[model samples]
Target: MRPPIDSGTVLITGACSRIGRELARQLARRARTLVLVAHQKEPLEELRDELLASNPTLGVAVEKCDLSHPDEVDALLDSLHRHLIQVDVLVNNAEQGEFGLYEQQRWPHIHQMLRANVSAPMLLTHRLLRRMVERGRGGILNIGSGGGRLYIPGMAVYAGTRHFLEGFTESLRLELVGTGVVVTRVEPGPVAVDAHAPPSWMSISAVRCAREALEGFERASPLVYPGLAYRWMMRLVSLMPRPLMRATGMMAAKKLRQGTALLEERGQRVLLAGGPEALSR
Candidate 1:
């Protein structure tokens, strides 16, 4: 049987962003309370209002927290404690990624990403997983990336962090086998977030990604690849040799080093353009 998600108090980080926002919307009808956490308060307030309008009985708590900072994370936890809310499900959905050569990337950006992507989730899990184990029924859903499985010259630190999540989640699932606490990690490839940009056949909408993630979480899947095509692609990538993947990465790196690859910042996403037509656009 799948682990129960209904009537639970769920805490979701990156609550205002694409996947996190979709997760909140989908779970609002089933979850008793949704504790929304993000760096900004305004967006969370707006989303909170929208959710309540849809599900009047649903409880919503908006927390403004910069996950990169340790003190703010502590404050978030303290606030939840003061409110007497025991989280039954924890969704570590917040993330940071950079598309550039590792050495060329800003140290501050790298540091912040490490804290947000690695330390925050680890601390949150450590702080909350004990209670879940005690209760013997709970969930932890980690929103990671496909970068974890491949050799990417750029986004090295981000990929490393995701690899950590992949290992941590798999090992935690093993330890929690008989404890009844469901642990799952969703590695989404390309989730469609923009309406104006040209759509890719490989990209799935945020809603579909969230829906698939929840389905996998309920089934207690150790790892989940969101889109159908992306899922099959990841499976194939796993079957291939590491040297072959490295060779592909080297070819991309060659383009980047030779100035043929252009990294364009589109809204929240970083787009990598390879050819003349791509660069022209």
Candidate 2:
């Protein structure tokens, strides 16, 4: 069984993209109100319309702002505050990943990735944690990647940021132990959202992933892995020696790169539903 969110407002970052979009859609029907955050203006608006079209009674507000820019996030939050918005659930779902050696990765891109994946969520939590603490009830789900626990060669920075969240969420959960405020870290495997280049792994649909994630959210678990396959894979990987895990990551990355090259040569970019840049970048 899970707790109901009849009167709580939910805020979802990157709400126009694959997983985020699906999460917003799933929660809109049950959640009292929703604040959707995304970087692009037009797409965010489009998502807002789509949601409203389906659920006219749903209270949905779209904020077009780049989470990579702390200033913009602050502005958006400030606007929400001025309007007396009360958030009861937060989904830190915005993140960008770059695959390559740390030395070869561009610095600017790394900084943006860090800001989006780590700093932005941390900042948002810092600002909103007080409210949830004061109200003595709410939930915060930090969406992370399996790379947080499993080492992958081409994703050092990505892995580090996700691992940091693993530690951060655990510590926060302890602090909010008796406060009725729950914190959970949701680690989903290679979602079909951005699994264009792959070794033919079965990627779970974004809607399915969101559904499973929210099921865990309602349970208020401290940590959740969405799919059974991901759970089994993690268990098996955890049993493997560290050296073996590293070798497997290298092999996987190599295979992905080979596929990417093949697709690029054909002048056809494999991407998520919305657009190519949305997935490839």
Candidate 3:
């Protein structure tokens, strides 16, 4: 059974951009109170204002903390608890990805990505899961990627982190079988959030993906594909042999390199900097 929609507050991490921002807006329509969390203050403030503009009486709060830092993540949660705030919906939307080979990636960036993508979520969920279990009514939505299910070269660490989340979510669902708390893992393929793919791919818009995620949450679905393409892709990938999948990934990588080289030759800035695209390889 699904939980009541308008009964409580929701806390969304990485609530400042793209899918996270849209999810916040949609949830705000049903949730009585919202806590928007992000690493940057400016975007969070902007989102808070935007929400307030839409719902004048909406109780929107902004929290700024670097989740990559364990201390900061804990401190942020502590501050919320101090204010007597209870998170009925915990959207672990924050993620950091890599764009290069594992060995080529700097130690600091890899460490930070691991911390934010894996450690922070694990720690935060550990703290909140117990409470949600006790309450017997809560929603946990984790934003994952298709990289986890496929063998992508440049994203070794990134895919590893997402795969861990996927495994964790499944194990957690089993553990909470009889509990009312719902756990959802959203694996979106080529979201239009500055992905590193060539310009030909039609990636799902972030808003569309966010809407699907919220809809899935309402239905208490354990896993959701943000778009039809991704759903079909998952099935296809699952049917492919392991070695075949690796070979396909290699072919895709070679094509991407070819395109990148062509663009660079034409004096086009081959790198798409900033936003989620920077995370893409």
In order, the Cα lDDT scores of the candidates are: 0.85, 0.79, 0.80
Give, for candidate 3, the lowest lDDT window spanning 10 residues.
Answer: 193-202
TM, every model: 0.90, 0.85, 0.88
Q: Which residue runs does candidate 1 get wrong by more than 4 Å?
A: 195-199, 260-281
lDDT for position 92 in model 2: 95
Root-mean-square deviation per candidate: 4.6, 4.7, 4.0
The candidate 1 region of ten consecutive residues with least summed lDDT is: 272-281
Over 139-215, each residue of candidate 2 has an lDDT whose tens digit, in order, gives 88899877788876557778888888999998998998888887888888766645233323545767777888888
Arranged by TM-score with the best first, the candidates are 1, 3, 2
* TM-score between candidate 2 and the true structure: 0.85
Q: What is the Cα-based lDDT of residue 70 in candidate 1?
A: 88
Q: What lDDT is reached at residue 120 by model 2? A: 95
Mind giving the per-residue lDDT tens digits that candidate 3 earns over 138-222? 8788988777787776677777888898999989878888888888888877777542323334477777788888788788888
Return the top candidate by lDDT: 1
Per-model clash counts, in order, read 0, 0, 1
